[model samples]
Target: MRIVFLLCSFLSLFFASELITPLPLHINYDKSKAILGKKLFFDPVLSKDNTISCAHCHNLQEGGDDGLEVSVGIDGKLGSINAPTVLNSVYNIAQFWDGRAKNLQAQAIEPIHNPVEMGIEDTKALLKKLKNNGYEKLFFEVYTDGLSLKNLVDAIAEFEKALITPNSRFDRYLKGESILSQEELSGYELFKSIGCISCHNGILLGGNFYQKVGIYEPYYADENLGRFSVTKLEEDKYYFKVPTLRNISKTAPYLHHGKVTSLKDTIQIMAYHQLGRELETLERDLIYKFLLTLDGDIPEILNEK
Candidate 1:
């Protein structure tokens, strides 16, 4: 009853005003710093074995994710959770599925320190390597302090801030610069009417808040306790930071576990567990089509020399 009432309210609000907004075409950042960060992002030297880079799990060219159910890290270590797309992540209120990191800057250096990820145990050793490998000069050019961990992650965060994807068909439609097909339009209506907007409303269609994965029913039994891991509260047990829908179709194998590969299956699961409702075949198809329209243009920074 509560969910139904909220759904009705959200549906009404959707009609009254825009529930989602378009991504800006550009965001300001230090180009020199971001360029330096880009180099560091792709550099393997950050890893313990120098075999893994941020791009190893996040392939910027391909949906900003590695296209794997679980990320493969340094020494072929398997990550516990699926790798979320880095595109448009700057807008997220918090970072990671668990919302453990407060922001991009906080999230940047985590992988390097994670044993299963980049695994850089000795910070001083890593800094020494950076100084010898041309990064010191780059750091000097970008920051007066030269090479340091703070500046390192700061530059990487700046690059990440420039990773916003804009100009999706839906965004253009929202701006009255383009139009959606009737089916897509209907799908959008269904998305709002069916309570998806209750949790997914915002410029990113999510990422603004945390929500339980199994609001109406249990989705799965896993060791990961989502936000509970960070908060250590029983109430937070299945709650996760809502992911953005931008490039949803491309970031296959959805959810924190990434157990479901097909988008249709993922939708069905969300409908059953999150909404406690079953979607008809046509309805699911329509919603899927609408979601495809959410894919946006790649960040222009990727092409910058």
Candidate 2:
């Protein structure tokens, strides 16, 4: 057992050295707020029932998601939409599938009051509850107003901004710091040639824009009107926020609906329906290898907490 453990550790270290690459260029965020945000993120007091934290939906150990088809919110009410991984969310052009929230600050306050989510009616009341706890000192130190809804959202947003996923194999190859196997490189070519990169570009990959799901294939019809809920435009029906591919390996159950499970299935679906291309078996395998490179290690603080 000891010898096996030693071998495993050695292998991990070896891989971490070669495969661990830094983030894509554009995701600029503050480190100072990230520390405070990480703590506030795990604190359940943010929820009205004092049961769920941000971690409930976006668990760090579970690739920043809770591994559910649909996340259960306050009182165990299953939310309508699948939860997206919080990892690399800082790269998202907008928040939520519907593109409802404009930034992290606006996004943070949403769950706190959602009857199905945190269930907190009042932000001030929630802050008051957490005031006497460890947050009080931290709050006072971080913000001038201290414990206000603005500060609460700001702090959480700050932490989220730091949750950027760098050091993926794709990133390493992109930086010219390392090279990918020929198959992986071939997969990247297919990915770009098939127009997958059109929307899923930039540092966060796909979060920079919104696109219609059925552009190539009919989206599985559901009552959940995506961006239409926000825009109220008839043309906006079935449109959803383009998700970032950073840590794609970890954030499974792809698409806004989470109908597809495997990365290969997703690639095939995209090619068949969206891109109007058919990928060969070797091509699909290469793409899968490239996608696998997106998985990353979690922050040490989140694990300790």
Residues 206-260, candidate 1, lDDT per residue (tens digit)? Answer: 9998888887778774677899999999889888999998899999888899888
| C-alpha RMSD between model 2 and the true structure | 10.6
**Can you tell me which runs of candidate 2 are displaced by over 4 Å?**
1-32, 300-305
Q: Return the top candidate by lDDT.
A: 1
1-305: candidate 2 lDDT, tens digit per residue: 33553354345433433322357433555555667888778888888878999998998777888777778998889887789988877667889998899998999989888889889997667877887676777877877676678887887887787676566777777677557887787777666655666656666667776777766557664677788999999978887887877777777787777767887888888777665568888888888888887765565445433
- Residue 136 C-alpha lDDT in model 1: 86
Indicate the residue-level lDDT of 154 in model 1: 92
Best by TM-score: 1
* lDDT (0 to 1) per candidate: 0.88, 0.74
Error at 38, model 1, angstroms: 0.6
**All candidates: CA RMSD (Å):** 1.7, 10.6
